[model samples]
Every structure is written in C-alpha cells, then in structure tokens.
Target: KKMIHAGAGVVDYDYRGEVGVVLFNHGTEDFEVAAGDRVAQLVLEQISMAPCVEVEALEDTARGAGGFGSTGVEATPAKRARAEAAAGGAAMGAASAAERTPHVAGEERAAAAGGAEVA
Candidate 1:
C-alpha cells in the first residue's frame, strides 16, 4: 500500500452537513482507487465526556517528560560526554597544555628536558 491511514475526529452533535473523509497519498509510489473500490472505512462510536478536575499540579510519574524512545536511545560517545558534562563534569573542559602535567621528575628533569642548567 502506498499510504492508507485511518483516524477519528470529533463530530459535533448539531452538525448537518456531510462529513467528508480527507485521504492523502504521500508515498514513493502512486495509489489508485478505482470506482466502487474500497478506499476507506469509517467506524462510529459514542464518546463520553471526561470532566476536567482542577488541582495545583499533576503527580509526577516514572516516565516524566520522557518520550519517543527516550528510554530506549543508547548512549553514544557524544551523548555520554554530554551526560557527563550535565552531571557536573562540564567544568572540566579541554585541558590546556600549560595545565597538563606529564610525569615531571623535578628541577633536574625540567633542565634535562630543556637541555639547560637549573638556575
């Protein structure tokens, strides 16, 4: 099938005009609907009213704010880095060469590395 979808929308009780179904085709291939062919079907059902109750705020759940595979998305290298940063590691940005220590022995080691006497 190129594209066949079905959904329900609210129909008011006082409506008098005919309810039209909007069908669309947004696939790579073309979909043909010949005459007398079944293109779509509509299922009618009674919908009940759900009274809204007011309160300060809704209680939080275990899946609060998580959506669309947020719980399933694996931590990539970049994501891991970002999570580490968000967990207070962001302050440890790229260490500069001056701030890095490469196993320095002492003054003698520094002099030997520089090929000069330690004054």
Candidate 2:
C-alpha cells in the first residue's frame, strides 16, 4: 500500500536556500516524521543545456503538432503485441543509446513503433 506520494525534487544550480520537500499522505492514518528521519533520497546529477535557435517554419509531417492520443490509438493487448513485434520484440521500441535518434513523427515514426496509422 502507498502511504505517501513523493514526486521528484529539482534544485536549481544557482538557488542558495534551504531545500524543502513536500510529502503528500495518501492514507487515512496520520503520519509523523521526527528529526533526522529519512523521508526521501536525493541524488545529484549534472545536466546539459543546448542552445535554442529560432526557425521561420517547422518541418511538415503527417502528425504535425499532434500531442498524446492525437493518433487515436488504444492500449489493447493485441495492438501492444503487434507493436512489440514491429520493434524487434523490444519494449516500447526503445532504442539503445547508440541507436537513439531524434523524436520521429508521422507515418514513418508510427510504423517504426508499430503504432496505428495516423489518418
């Protein structure tokens, strides 16, 4: 059973202040935390920022500007199996680090992921 709802905490690089953690209790009973009690774990990771460039127009694609569920795909067992098969039995067609490519869209991307055709 889940008693607490803890989300990822992000501390900016240039913020000089006390780090605070927000914990949400999802249980009916009351929860208590004493001094020096371990409520969560923190891991420091380095992130990189890429330069942003302005473009006049974005590339045209079949699924252009389509967000989640824009392709009208249902998460069915049979469809999932087909998707897995198309991805060489890989889970969610996730590519290895070396084979990672930029976000693909439109028919090609869907076909590669074994997703349903987008209009």
38-58 per-residue lDDT for model 1 (tens digits): 766767778778898899988
Which candidate comes out best when scored by lDDT? Answer: 2
Q: List the residue pairs that clash in candidate 2.
A: none
Candidate 2 Cα errors over 4 Å, as ranges: 74-119
Q: Give the TM-score of candidate 2.
A: 0.57
Question: Clashes in model 1: which pairs?
Answer: none
Over 4 Å off, model 1: 1-14, 25-38, 73-119
Instruction: Please write out the lDDT profile of model 2 over residues 63-119, one tens digit for every residue.
Output: 789988886664434455466687667454433211332344444444554454433
